[model samples]
Target: MSFCLETYLQQSDDYEVLINKAGFKDCARLIRFKADEVIYVKPGEVILGVRIIGVPPIPIGIIENEKKLLIPYTKPCHGTSVVELPIDKKEIDNIRKLAI
Candidate 1:
């Protein structure tokens, strides 16, 4: 479960500083500070790091008939990027699993 910076960047259209698995689908703006960026996470939140995990196949439904399938639809599992504050043990575990 390695983290994928590119995917995370793409998913985070605004380049959000905070990204969590639970809110991955939802795009949120990031708050930057002179020391570092901050992303608010509630208690029991899960945050992963960037890394490459495995190869997963893409569904044909997502592919367009006329679209060029250049690169195999399969891609590695992408982890999320998050700030280190009030660090949660569980989030650390997930990041470790992803080798982030």
Candidate 2:
């Protein structure tokens, strides 16, 4: 399926997202968290982590070369504009296995 970054950003925890599909209305809130922090995502929910590139007023691609995922402001005490995962793929895969 095609992805929409605008829709994803609108789903932030502090923000709200609305979509109309098959004559049905779907709504969700956007949630933001720091890298390495744990946030509870409900079942059946689609979670996406997008990397914010460059400063405000200029838009950039979240996918780097269409392969690697980008993360922003991984350090502590940074602004709320963080976009990235602190854990590596191995750790994420291990956690996924554990969940199963």
Candidate 3:
């Protein structure tokens, strides 16, 4: 399935927002600190149909037990947010391919 993060966030209640209206660096740190495993991707790499914005080697958090992925999402005026959502294996594999 093609997952649209924005649509999912708007229409579903299954996701978790770890932090909202925060800086990129702070969100990144929360991902690293909370997730079971951490991986890096380029700044503009797209995940869940959104372009991730951050410093070099942006962090993506993987929580194995919960089958969730933690990402720092940034918008024009909303600042950055750390969001966690359930992800399937296939999507996880796709994300791993973009790892730095």
Candidate 4:
């Protein structure tokens, strides 16, 4: 079964936020998420089960070493943030499937 990103965010507090309320470019810079790891999806691509909202073809970074998911979360009022949250091995595999 596939894990939903939105559901996970709401139901689980196990994740960690590396940065909050920051711009996408900044987040990309900080994490240095490997270019290969970045997944280009539609602005509203439903990852896992979460509708990933961001600029078109948003950049989602993954760090293999830390098993962290680097996502750019955007809101109209606060701008976007680079969030680094820990994910399980299964979830990681699912994310890789979404990348294209």
Candidate 5:
């Protein structure tokens, strides 16, 4: 997939930033607390067009009712952010396949 998270965030307004400029642990905790279901993925997995980085078993939150995904997005200077974005069933399935 050629999806670029930076480009998407810049070009689109379809996503929501739940928590921004926070530490990785804080973001991870938010996902676990807010999400309907949680899935663990290995660090460096390509999710929503970005490679997630952090400790092992990175948390990806799935809100089935909203059809949305919550993920921690990290950048060098910006730290980590929890982004909630709508996703389709196919994409959700694909993400589930990568779960550890």
Candidate 6:
């Protein structure tokens, strides 16, 4: 409830970016180190109320009994990284709702 992906992306500076200007593959590789399972997402799809960015079929990692949704947020300069920030149940569910 406290961590909203949409709002965090806009209003906060309290998250960690492991890498920048990278790609989904890099993020996915990093996820393996932290998450228990991974959910691959199709390109041009929305999750956590935002459009997922990747080549195609991006990977989303979940952990701690689905309490967290690990998403790879990509930008033109900051390519992609597994956003290591706390998220709520509703946000996790939204990502599940759009899972491939």
Winner by lDDT? 5
Q: Predictions ranked by lDDT, top down? A: 5, 3, 6, 4, 1, 2
Q: Which lDDT tens digits does candidate 5 get at residues 30-61?
A: 99999998999999999877788888789999
lDDT of 6 by residue, 1-100 (tens): 4434678767877666666666677787887677876777788686656777776667787785746657788777756767866666776666677667
Q: How accurate locally, in lDDT, is each candidate?
A: 0.28, 0.28, 0.89, 0.69, 0.90, 0.71
List runs of model 2 lying over 4 Å from the truth. 1-84
Question: Please, what are the lDDT tens digits per residue for candidate 4 over residues 23-88?
Answer: 777766655544336766676666656777765657777776777777777678887666667766
Report the lDDT tens digits of candidate 3 across residue range 1-100. Answer: 6778888899998888999999988998899899888989999888998788888889999887789999888887999999999998888888989998
Q: What is candidate 1's lDDT per residue for 1-100, written digit by digit as tens?
A: 6544445545655332444432222212221221232223332223334232212211111112222111111132543333223323454434334321
> TM-scores of the models, in the given order?
0.19, 0.19, 0.93, 0.67, 0.93, 0.74
Kindly report which residue stretches of model 5 are placed more than 4 angstroms away from their true locations once superposed: none
Look at candidate 3 and tell me the lDDT of residue 70: 96
lDDT of 5 at 69: 90
For candidate 1, which ten residues in a row score worst on lDDT? 54-63
Q: Regarding lDDT, does 2 or 4 come out ahead? A: 4
lDDT at 50, model 2: 30
What root-mean-square deviation over C-alphas does model 2 reach? Answer: 15.6
For lDDT, candidate 1 versus 2, the one ahead is 1
TM-score of 6: 0.74
**Better candidate number, 1 or 6, judged by TM-score:** 6
- Residue-wise lDDT of candidate 2 within 1-100, one digit each (tens)? 5443345445544322222221111111111111132233223322233332322322111222222222222123433233332234543443333221
Candidate 4 minimal-lDDT segment of 10 residues = 27-36
lDDT of 4: 0.69
Residue clash pairs of candidate 3: none
